[model samples]
Target: MATEAPQRSQLSLRPLERDGFTARVLRSLTAFIQTADLKPGDRLPTERTLAAQLGVSRSTIREALQTWQAMGVVQIRKGSGTYLARDVRATSLHVPVTINLERQAVLDSLELRRAIETDAARLAARRGRSEDVERMRVALEEMEAAYAEHGFAIRQDRAFHEAMFTASRNPLYLQIFQQVINRISDAFNESRENPFVTEPYADESQPDHRRLYEAVACRDEAGAVAAVTRIIDFVESTLRHDE
Candidate 1:
């Protein structure tokens, strides 16, 4: 009897629910963009088809597309349906190779080159056509001429690698490899102690270059891998010694 009965309060806890419709629709559209490798001017599926695929209403899909269009991520065509915007960004190209000069970065990049390019060169040798072989030969010739005349053969070097990648017959690989090499070449040139204007690469580099070219010309896969690896290793060693 000392205290009045305590008042009892009832509390109800409800589990949190996430919005499903918009998020799912957006994710579905994003995945389609990536999987199709859709470039600018590529048309997306009709609203009906997209809605069916996403298991949502057409309104929801339309809403998502509208949001993307507002963000300049996609474009809507009059009576022509929706198309990807002109500014779709490819991640690899835009990514910056910073100047942290991390030891791991160099090692990793080299490792990637060795893993992919060794096989690329091997393929170039085994399957390359006469035109490809001739192209490589021309590149080497130009490189030699540059050596003798100017000591630097920037264009020639790029041409040789481009020919090798073309020989691989894999377009995706060729595109990415070319980009990587281009960046590396820029860095390598910048890091050189003596420009082509001053000191040319040692004569030994010519023979190694010739060896690689011949391997592709002759369709000698193993020889091509060996030649490429040897040439790259030599360059790396020389650079390290200079450093």
Candidate 2:
């Protein structure tokens, strides 16, 4: 037997757009929960219900919730609805924060990303589960689709890295990377200097990502490390050339 969905109150903001608009949406949703006196462990409205209430599409709700889930603020249980995973203000205060990065800071961060990511790739090749391979594949296909539409993929790009971190079977790696992603992506996007986002290299990167996936899929540690190096090398060269 099917149960009926419940009605929800409409949010104040409507019609969210791009350019950090998603961040604003998340903020607004958090505010809604806070003002409503919602507490940790409180169940949230379903996506369809939330979208209707927020005057946005269900996809927007899903995206915001995904980010919130990643941030440890919310949890989605299969057939059990969503719940506030932690107290919002606590997570806000405890997570390591990233401020606006300078050019040198960006480079340093990339170097750190390169270091952590290469090792993570090697570990993924040795330790990856079947689910990990599938996730990388889905993220790759999403990247292709996003490229077909918008010339480059931003969220999919991040998703791929997140998949790799998960595939590595290393929780700390994913935790650390997620903590820095907002600042790192901001620096890369604002500069427009990423090899993966520009032409020639951008086109070349599709196969590179494929190769990285294959290396991990086959449990080829050396191959995975090499593939990661090749990808990061392009970024290092591009950034250096620009300098």
Among residues 3 or more apart in sequence or in different chains, the pairs in candidate 2 whose N, CA or C atoms overlap within 3 Å are: none
Question: After best superposition, candidate 1 residue 129: deviation in angstroms?
Answer: 1.0
Taking all chains together, each candidate's TM-score versus the true structure is: 0.57, 0.61
Tens-place lDDT per residue, model 2, 67-179, is: 67877878988999889987765235323334446767767767777888999999999999999999998998898788777777878877997898899998778877785
Q: What is the C-alpha lDDT of each candidate?
A: 0.67, 0.75
Worst 10 residues of 2 by lDDT: 90-99
Best by TM-score: 2
Cα lDDT tens digits for candidate 1, 19-111: 566545555556556655667888888888776656667887787676567445678987999998854444423222222234345545566
Question: Candidate 2: misplaced stretches above 4 Å?
Answer: 1-70, 74-84, 87-94, 97-100, 188-196
The TM-score, computed over Cα atoms with residue i paired to residue i, of candidate 1 is: 0.57
